[model samples]
Target: MRRHTDERAHVLVLHGGQQHSTEPTSWRQLSVLRSRLFAAAVARAGRQDRIGVSFLRYAQRGWNDGAPLRDATWALARVREEHPGIPVGLLGYSMGGRTALHLAGEVDALVTAAAWVEQADLPAVHPPTSGRALLLHGTEDQMTSPEGTLRAAERLREQGAEVDVRTDLADTHGMMRHRADWHRLAGAHLVQTLRTSTCDAGGRGAD
Candidate 1:
């Protein structure tokens, strides 16, 4: 699999669903939107010097019944192999959000927008413990259940994972109504978590 690489801390973004497509044009819009959001967040957090963004495209446009999760795991392995000790974050929208949550153990931080987590097979998957996660959902989302998102957050919390759930009353499943808020929150979380991890690693090494 091909990826965009740079010297700064890496942020891997996964876009929402599209019908399985062989053409690149089908995912162009979502890819652009996810990339811009990550860039905006990094800029807002003054992490332009610390963060580099990459958009991950799945072989299939659909979630593919857990295939995307496996793809994400492979991608994370690749990132860890190439970057070694560097910080890495995962951000996902809609179906991609569910995939990110599933693979949260592999990254330093996670940010999900309207994650379709209620439908995820939670019993078979383990919650994240190594990193923190931010879950953003709208109260009026028509496509996915907000209650479901909250429930997933609760489960993560129960599993001793650091999870923050934010609700936008005026937004929808797409969260376009208050896009800036999403960027600001996500960017801050990414920066904080990565920095915290670095500090913890340094402390351990000093011992």
Candidate 2:
């Protein structure tokens, strides 16, 4: 893992998973591979800036009633341990997005990509007290509920979150249809939210 010990800001990237499964995760999985690629793109896009990124791959494949959340908690703690009080961001997809929801309150900014949000999940979200959030989803996403994502965004907004929700027309849960757009939205969110344009890099990556 690379280290940007002087990083001014940080981003933790998380991949998606199923709602109910205990299967171990691997780099070969589509969701994990996609997020790894996405994290690299974010790092490259923010190359001129000072940002540290860590991509967290959960030990198991499913949400499994908060198993991924536990992993994310540890990852965030790791980031805090590494960077201390520097601004932090959370970027997650699907089930990982669900995990991010539980931890968003701890970061400076958050981006949920094609997240699998349910009405019941909103209560667990304690909006970033001094931060904000962005929710991205596809209109045609069959695997996750775009409406639910929007609803979650609304709830976040009502709770005083500076929320912005965008939709990809005719896209799906895979995020491959409009890959660059996802990159643009998610990457821009990190750079803008973290304000790392002038910050340093070679930040540690979560392996």
Candidate 3:
């Protein structure tokens, strides 16, 4: 695992899919992608000083029967070891989103794009969160239907979470990377909601 400091909130970006897409080479590529996206998003967010990003690489695993949760568990353990004082936020794309939700307890906030949902893991409402959960899905996503994210949102809300679900009909699964407007919109909303949630928690703690 490698760490990179930036300006917003300390983030742990988990990458989706294998390196070669066909070869599933351990989690080296996943870690690399995680770091890359973290750097890019932090730069775009213009909160480089407030955020620090890190990546956790693991052994190779298959998509259908992958050890994503196991890898995530290990990754969070490492995060705890290195930066116990920092609140962790997760940004995962596609398969990485699935892993993020599966390991949601470890993060203060979750920003998932084009997440693949499994019925077994589906919460009657959105997944419970101590902080917040943001689901970003493309209305025109051909790979994973927007319905999946909508359902997840429903479950998360039911679970007593402050949830936000946004749809970008014009953006494809990977389109958020190319579309600055979409990225800014999504990122801003996420930052605002996270701060709100954190402030609320602090207020309660003070009381």
Candidate 4:
């Protein structure tokens, strides 16, 4: 078996997007810029250079027919191929969160911020069978419903994964109202998950 030589942990970052469209995404998109902030903040919160951050630039701007999922799969394959058995995590916002949640079974850890979840989004809630998940949702999100995120969390628990759901009161869909807390919680979760589930990230181990 190939061993994990690098001590650094890898995180694949995914940004938010639209719905039912076919436009290609770009770095100039505000959605990508927001996710870029997430990546940078998470990296800084982590063990400095020990955390490898790669923000995925998707081919399209929407989740049309699971295009984002495909792009994420491709990106993950690259990460695994180059880094082999290193601890890998997924961090996403909104539509990107939806995409990461869809592929939770394949990574060591995952963080979903302001995840876009509707009734239709439940079918893709594949929690990490051998890892952990952190769901961060704002209590006052105007775009994605926090109730929907709660429902998704319920499914994640039912599937028998170690899941942590945190609510940021007064924050909105953009997750900027308490930006420092959001970054601290999410970045801490990802790095701590990479370390160990029983660590000080305030998460429990798998049952």
lDDT for predicted candidate 2 compared with the true structure: 0.81
lDDT tens digits, residues 1-207, model 2?
224757777789999888888899999999998888778877876666668888998999988888998899999999999888678888888887888888888888798888888888888887764456888998888899898888888878878888878885568888888888888888887788777322322243322
Off by over 4 Å in 2: 196-207
Task: Give the Å error, residue 102, model 1.
Answer: 0.8
What TM-score does each of the candidates earn? 0.83, 0.90, 0.75, 0.88
lDDT of 4 by residue, 1-207 (tens): 112235467788999999876888888888798889899887776655376788898988988878999999999999988876567889989999889888887887889999887788787787764457889998888888888778888888888877889875689888887888889988998887876632323244222
Error of 2 at 4 (Å): 2.4
| Model 4: lowest-lDDT 10 consecutive positions | 198-207
Count clashing pairs, candidate 4.
0
On residues 1-207, what C-alpha lDDT tens digit does candidate 3 reach at each position? 234452234556666664223355453454445435544664456353354556544455335565766787787777767665445667767766777777776567777777776666674223435546888777777776678778777777766777878775577766554456545654664466545545665677789
Q: Pick the candidate with the highest TM-score.
A: 2
Off by over 4 Å in 4: 1-7, 197-207
Candidate number that wins on TM-score, 2 or 4? 2
Candidate 4, clashing residue pairs? none
Candidate 1: residue 180 lDDT (0-100): 82
Sort every candidate by TM-score, greatest first. 2, 4, 1, 3
